[model samples]
Target: MLLIILGLALWIGAHFLKRLAPDLRARMGNSGKAVLGVMIVLGVVLMIIGYRGAEYVELWPKVQALVGINNLLMVFAFYLYAASGMKTAITRKIRHPQLTAIKTWAVAHLLVNGDLASLVLFGGLLAWAVVQVILVNRADRNWVRPAPVPMSREVMAVVGALVVTGIVMGIHNWLGVQPWG
Candidate 1:
């Protein structure tokens, strides 16, 4: 639990730092892109290690799987993720699709995962996502609302997101720990 908390703190801290200190972040990106990249890599590596360390956590019991509902939520999360990327029309409406994706992803997981660590990780992310969107809305000069994109693009987004979501779901067990273990 400690390891998981620490790892998440580091990972989320780094991301939040950028938003809170845009000038500092910009300076680093401008003058030390390579170094910044390395730092990000190291941070991610530590987060993975820390999360793995706590994956064997018996601190909380596993919740029974609601396979059908869980899958449905994941599918919607993927749709939002993919919708943000496609330029067909939806992309023009929202300034940030990926953040929207994160919001959806976090919420979806919260419903499926009933553990302290899962709550911490997903809840923290969801909070951050809300903050980010609020900040962007406040900071941006103009907000454009575009028309709906073509149906084909939505379909493509769904397909693309499904593939990526499938891979992540598959590897999540090996990467973190078992669902019911």
Candidate 2:
């Protein structure tokens, strides 16, 4: 639990350093990017280790029905994540689609896996995403919506997202969680 908390803090802190401490971040310049990348990688490693080591205390009975909902939400999450990098209709409407996707993914996991580990992992990520989005919005007040891309590009992006989602679902069991059943 402590490692997980520390990892979450380091991950979120490294991400927000540029926005929260602009002068300090600017001082580091290019080296700061490398340091941030290392922090992110280390944070993820610690989080995985801590989460896997932590005991699972079920908070609610697992609902098989929520599996379907989780899958649907994950699909949308992947699509939104992909859309964030593209000038699609989705990006035009959603200023922070990647963060929204993270929140959606966290919520989806929470809905199905009501356990201590899941709660800590997903809830912490959800909180981080929310805070990060708020900080990003505050930093860039004048939000200029991107121009709409071609419909075909949007379709391709969705198709790509679907492919990625399918791959993830296929390997879900190997990851120790059977997302399907």
Best by lDDT: 2
Each prediction's Cα lDDT score? 0.68, 0.89
Candidate 2 lDDT at 75 equals: 93
Q: Give the TM-score comparing model 2 with the true structure, all chains together.
A: 0.96
The residue-level lDDT of candidate 2 at 180 comes to 86
Q: What's the true lDDT of residue 99 in model 2?
A: 93
Q: Which segments of candidate 2 are over 4 A away from where they belong?
A: none
For candidate 1, write residues 1-181 as lDDT tens digits: 6655665565566666666778887877655556556555666675556554555434444455554566666777777777876754556766777787788778767766666667776777788788878877777858776577678997898788789767777787776644332
Instruction: Choose the strongest candidate by TM-score.
Output: 2
